[model samples]
Target: MTDDVVSALLHPIYVRLQETAVPAGGAGSEYILFFSYTDGRNRARVETFRGPTFADAWHRGLARLRKVVAKHPDMIRWLRVDTVDEMRRSNWAELKRQLTEVKRNYCRQGISLDRNCRHAFLETEINANAMFYGGVEYPHCVVNEKNFRLYAKLRHGLGDVDLKDATLVWMFSSRGFFLDKERPDEVHEIAGPGRSAGCRIVEALDDDLLSKVIKSSSTFLTGQVGDDGRFIYGWHPCFDREIQAYNSLRHASTTYAMIEAWEVTQDAALWAAIERSLAWLLREAICTVTLPDGTEAAFLVDVGNEIKLGANAVAILAFTQHAVVGGCIDHLPLLEKLAQGVLHMQQSKDGSFVHVLNYPDLTVKEAFRTIYYEGEAAFGLMRLYSLTGDERWLSAVEKAFDHFIAKEHWRHNDHWLSYCVNELTRYRPQERYLRFGIENVRDHLDFVLNRITTFPTLLELMMASEAMLARIEAMPDMRHLLGEIDLSKFHRALHFRARYLLNGYFWPELAMFYAKPQRIVGSFFIRHHAFRVRIDDVEHYLSGMVAYRSKLIGNSNRVRKAEATV
Candidate 1:
């Protein structure tokens, strides 16, 4: 059998064997046994067996095959036994040469996987022009090939028994078994076309295998950020070692993981890490390099800083909330200081926050960027007011709300609006605030009923609806505001919220409002409708709201009680 014929059948199976051995910790040992068979006509079949325990796995496979052959007489004729040891002795050196050729042609150059050749497997060459956009760089790092080669050489030098056994098995299989059952002439004829097609197929297979390995590893690692500022995503070590940091991507992911950790464990260590991260952001990330004109230039280091307000707000809120909830309320003064900076940077004259800020200096050059910023800043300021009872903080919220109202921007079905409304209800629980919130709630509900169709959008609508329902029920007279809402649609929205949105830390607040009794204490004929949610889940939701308020406003019982009711 020709070397080409042996490779065509055994290589894929060999690769798969290595893949299957990847362990839970991403470190493991793999064993592959290749066997070759040949007919007198120079036809060959190459069969590869692989596993952690090769002997046992091979024996089990052989037993299964014997039973299958026993059932069919003609099958035994097709499976002719040849001299395995003789074939191995005859082809050992030739097989080694073929293996080296395979490594050089496929592994070194990378393999193409399709007719179009758009996709490839295992790139080693660097794209010199790929920009270093963000984060710290590690200079003069060695390439992945050098590292892998060193690892292989180290294994060889150690005279590792497993490595010797694996190599022997690989060489034996390449020459001893004609598993492919293709004639040498046939293989040579097909090699040209097959190599072209196989390159693409192999490339796709490599990508899929690499992706699976990465996803599995990430799950096992709990998305940990490495020292390089990148979460390990794939099986292959990054080819461009200098650019491996993943800088902004890793920061965002780590930020998310920290938030989740705080929500679950409330662990002090997690809080410390969060604070360190925030310090990293403030000191290293948000740049303040000045221009020659004595004008400041701010450069927020990440992409989210360039486009989205939600991520930034969440990062800030996570730190601020942790400071309050962790009883380090002493941090409130520092938080207030930061809040003032954010306020000056985020707030606009219309009482709205700018959507995007062009930094070193804060400048609003885009309108769409302001939408999420307004919603997020409103929520943040509301928390500040709730925490501190600072009229300045409340004043900031009022200005933001006034801008929101003047712009009449709450008509859309948006999660940002939902968050804003929830914050508004918490900070300002007067009849006017309740009335305004209820109207927006109705509008939001209408938008959902009319426009939202997907499951995810529906879930968001339900959460927003639940928040509004809670607010309405807290008021002394909320029945009038409920007039236009269809009971069936309301229940549908409620059920969806109960099923999906009501869970973890936010559930009790949602439940208390949904389960509480509403009492109407005003004239049903009044044109100006007022709504309220009775302070039933006050203990849990209020604690959170109080902590949020205490940080924002100042520690005061009246604002605390209002927060509880809202």
Candidate 2:
């Protein structure tokens, strides 16, 4: 089955390159064909073939591939092919200049230069002469026809070679291939089965496929929870090195994501894992404090003798989700205690909250930490409100919003804020809150659309905003606020971000390039950060995907119902 899956992904590359083998300019063109091979049991071998003619180079590479396949038939599990015509350099220099300008523009805008999920940005920058870089953008690298050797060497570590003649590079392996050339009208990309790394293919995001991705990813995450009821933290993946540090906030957030997934899959094993992880959090992280008012509150404390607002917030989220999904209220009292801890962190003067506090004694550790804690705390309160219908939770979130709006918190464009707004507006839906929700995602669409890393939180923000927008659009009175909003652009950003995220997903083919394919293949990775696969990384991706899938199914169901009524 694995062999067939791998071959099905590879065969298309062979056929597409065969069809485009000879450039339109035809004869007198120099062809450079490069192949990287691995059979899962051996170190990868990189081979390059060059000939004065396209047929000559292609046949040489093909012959070598055939020989390897014949010898290691069952073992030949991965192959990557890159073919380019040295003579197809029309406009290549101009395109190189434009690519440089794009990099400059990104720097000027303070945009990150990581190329993990920037295929769309590249396509726009070069007028379609672009491909996914799968790593940071190298200052020494240029994808122009004359610098294929430099491009290949820097990206794949394919040895220091001196070849300066190739344009229109067509690269493919397990996740399909795309061509980066000077002509927007002639750009071609083929998506493999399941997910397309760079190609604009929507079929891969179908419901059944997304469900499978969710299941597999959740299973990977659940498996990370040890018998001791704590997560293994994360991995660097490239060298199989474990990240030595752990965070209470991430543990709780990851647990929240797992419970969110369990809401979809209802797998018993996943539930057991969630129980163990929650137990670990309760046993080690939580501490109860006696308030000056003679009441007690429970705070989740990490390794340091500190209490982070986000840690307490996410713990509330995890416990609330566990209770809501498991159809049990056994955690209700604990959740209320956690909520009290969050309330204690808030400064009653201006509705702002302290970020961190020294544990046990409960003095402020730092007045501020990150922008995430405020929204996360508010979101956790909203979740608790949904479960208990407690007015205090709702009122606390509203008070936070007053500060968020007065300070124009929409500028941060945070996913947690989006989550909080979506949850808040469901009951409140006041004009100020509605505008805040819309403005949260309004101006940030282009940046979100063009961002390089999969940066999973952007999707979460978009999806949450999308939900808020759909609700607003349905209300007759509030519909006028959306007049200034380009609904199409907002929807496009959501769609593009959802699809572009696949570039960071470690589909088996791309995963083969790393040290341990089996361990990391199914999880989402941030290529810019040493291909890091941590619990929070997978959690954000899983949560966004689950929300996306829900949106898709919801749309499909609405359409079907509308058609039936018609």
Candidate 3:
């Protein structure tokens, strides 16, 4: 597997170099090889190798790489080759000196070069190169790295653990490497056969393009759902190992995204897959219980023992979307029961909800799991409110919003909250909800615009916020609020994020670099995480694309129609 990955990564460089006038091997004919290897988990190793030729440099680096690969047999390997002139022009010497200084500092502090030390070193290396394009004439980061890890650590106190959950981005034009969290995907593609042939530049995220992406990604996800309605879950494609773990929250949310995709493709096969998955969820995960008050409730049980608040919320989202989109209310009874289960979790005094409960007996297993559950529960309630016109659901969300506003939940930039606020304001337009919607995404514009990872939820949040903004724009009374916000920058973030997320999509061109490209060609991946393709990853990306297609593209079409009428 290591040899295969190494060979795949090297193949492209070999092909590109063959087209160049450079000789294969000679004195002072230097080649710089950057190698990245990961176990698809916590451990990763990156290094730079220089030699008279590509094979020589790879052979030299393989000795060190073999040690890591032996310990972690399931590994993803990436190699980038550059001429010594490119490295020199990109100021690689200065960057090497800085890295040497950092190592010395660690040595002075008596810090052994252990896992944490290696992680920090990787951070320092990535931070130094993510954004530095050598010059306009050269038009690429010659050194092939970025400074985002340092930026995120300094700005957000993002430590090694948090920084480890990152994705890698290769600017095909400049041969520079990037972490999705630190840099935006937009960059100058110059001085390469990849760019010169006009093959690497991504197309605009227009209606047609978004429709295609949404369909294909959803289709890939649909393929993961089998006859028994169980998802293949995900894959660490480096070794092609199917992820053994399953989360009910991810399952329900993925179903919700499939329904959203159904709105676009209307493919009957996809719908059939959706039905099978929902049937599996209902049969295996959901359980009906009678409370002390005699109200029947449905809870999504995971591993036959635990029930998560987010799971119930997304179950509501999935079933409600299924009911409305499929025009089948058979899930009505189940949906109502699900809402009752959610209400059971909510606190009467403060509207805060418990995050996890042990199933059957219904004891508190966890008080708070993640902030995402709060918004998801609210959004689920709001979505149910939209479907049934039930004030009970709306009132519950309102009470939760009271808690959210008091706690300043907007700082989390949660996508679910954005969805809830948008839905809430649509039915009952109010100042507080409007303000929350704006604040939810306003401060994160720079982060969203610059983000390199597909990081799907950012798009979902932006789309929901944009919808609220459009609603506000049309309201005579709320028009004044736009004055306080940079509407132009907000739009720019929306447009930029819509297009930039393509970096994570497994297009054939990119997937061909990985093992078993056929299985992964239409899915989304976390580049730094050994290009992991999980059900949730695809769900988030597909959901974001669906929202973009329906909201942004639909709005542009309506505007164009309005102009034509004028």
TM-score of each: 0.43, 0.78, 0.71
Q: Tens digit of lDDT per residue, candidate 1, span 329-394?
A: 755655565456445554466775555555434455464654555665666666666667788766
List, residue by residue over 490-526, the lDDT tens digit for candidate 2: 9999989988887767655445545565677678876
Best by lDDT: 2
The top-ranked prediction according to TM-score is: 2
Q: Cα RMSDs of all predictions?
A: 21.9, 7.9, 11.7
Q: Give per-residue lDDT, candidate 2, residue 223.
A: 85
Among all windows of 10 consecutive residues in model 2, the one with the lowest summed lDDT is 108-117
Per-residue lDDT of 149 in model 1? 35
The whole-model lDDT of each prediction reads 0.37, 0.71, 0.69
Better of 1 and 2 by TM-score: 2
Candidate 2, residue 539: Cα displacement in angstroms equals 1.5
Regions of model 1 farther than 4 Å from truth: 1-222, 227-261, 265-276, 287-312, 329-334, 345-348, 439-461, 497-566
